[model samples]
Target chain A: DAGITQSPRHKVTETGTPVTLRCHQTENHRYMYWYRQDPGHGLRLIHYSYGVKDTDKGEVSDGYSVSRSKTEDFLLTLESATSSQTSVYFCAISESTGSYEQYFGPGTRLTVT
Target chain B: AQSVTQLDSQVPVFEEAPVELRCNYSSSVSVYLFWYVQYPNQGLQLLLKYLSGSTLVKGINGFEAEFNKSQTSFHLRKPSVHISDTAEYFCAVSEKAGGSYIPTFGRGTSLIVHP
Candidate 1:
């Protein structure tokens, strides 16, 4: 297991409210990623950071924003939560993107009512 | 760009039965392949990966996958399965693009082992 942790393992929020999910890693991996898992959709990347203060949008970065201030922490913020945004979010870290595999955190389940 | 395809959405089998999960991928250039398993309410765990070398790659928990470059497929297989093997399996392919390595994932295939 990797030294990865996701805060607020579970959360429930109403629609139109702002919510932020935090991912922290102790492995000091160079690459960090955020993904959402749905029933039919296995896993879709939300955003990822290659280095501190640097981030890029994933395929499903429509209403999500992420920030990485340091090497260990990556934050995903939903400006105004929506019911459709309710899903399980997972944070993963990889030493390098080339041929290395990713390590995943337990995951955070968010519900938007 | 790289993409993955899991041929089956769900496969049900009896415990101790042999099982195989199909995975196919498409990429313009040479790519890396990986297989991951996700249990209920848990995150994905790497089962195995094929970067280079021999086509047969062994992984954890009595699992293995054979990477076929000609077919562009990395299919996961297990000789005998237990009840604990019930989980969702995902196939992924990674390739370098725009100076960054990006991975594309397949919609998982649920493996249900019944007693």
Candidate 2:
């Protein structure tokens, strides 16, 4: 929705395969986040980047990794996909870290077989 | 650490009926409250937020929420809901920690409006 876009909106992959999701923002926001949405879990943060090359893990960082080599792009990688990792992923951007509303992008739905 | 709890997992109501979605949070320091709505196959959109001055906050689509400091709760309410109002609502809380704000979100409440 806001100038954010996620690539590969839908994908199906087998177990133990590597997958990467890309998030691109045209707003030039300083903060970007990766989150996963499951049936019971609303949205769990996987990783976040404060700036280019500055990344940190979130509550559900296990089995996932992230990289931000540029201000406009953030990448989420799954080294070995599992059935448990199948979920809808969303990317969000914020102008500030505190009290600022985070704008979300169109989600990417990934299914692991 | 901050955590948000949404009391209802799902609520069903008829058109033109009123609705209330409950939310509570636990935090050690001051916090900011927010409500977000997600329609089918869509990303979340901000409905309202309680930053500082007002305890009662009005948001888009005639929705409103009240922040209660004593009860540590922020509940969303609407007097008259339309069929188009059916969606999933999520509550979130953010607090400053280590010079950064970390937000914690609730599971979410699914609102089903029937004719």
- DockQ for each numbered candidate: 0.78, 0.80
Clashing pairs in 1: none
lDDT value, residue B12 of candidate 2: 99
Which run of 10 residues does model 2 chain B get worst, by summed lDDT?
Answer: B95-104
Query: Model 2 residue A63 lDDT?
Result: 99
Q: DockQ score of candidate 2?
A: 0.80
lDDT of each: 0.93, 0.93
Fraction of true interface contacts that also occur in model 2: 0.68
lDDT of 1 by residue, A1-113 (tens): 79999999999999999999999999999899999999898899999999999899999999999999999999999999999999999999999886889999999999999
Model 2 clash number: 0
- What are the runs in model 1 whose C-alpha is more than 4 Å off? B96-100
Docking class of 2: medium
> What C-alpha lDDT, on a 0 to 100 scale, does residue A110 get in candidate 2?
99
State the fnat of model 1. Answer: 0.75
Model 1's TM-score against the true structure = 0.97
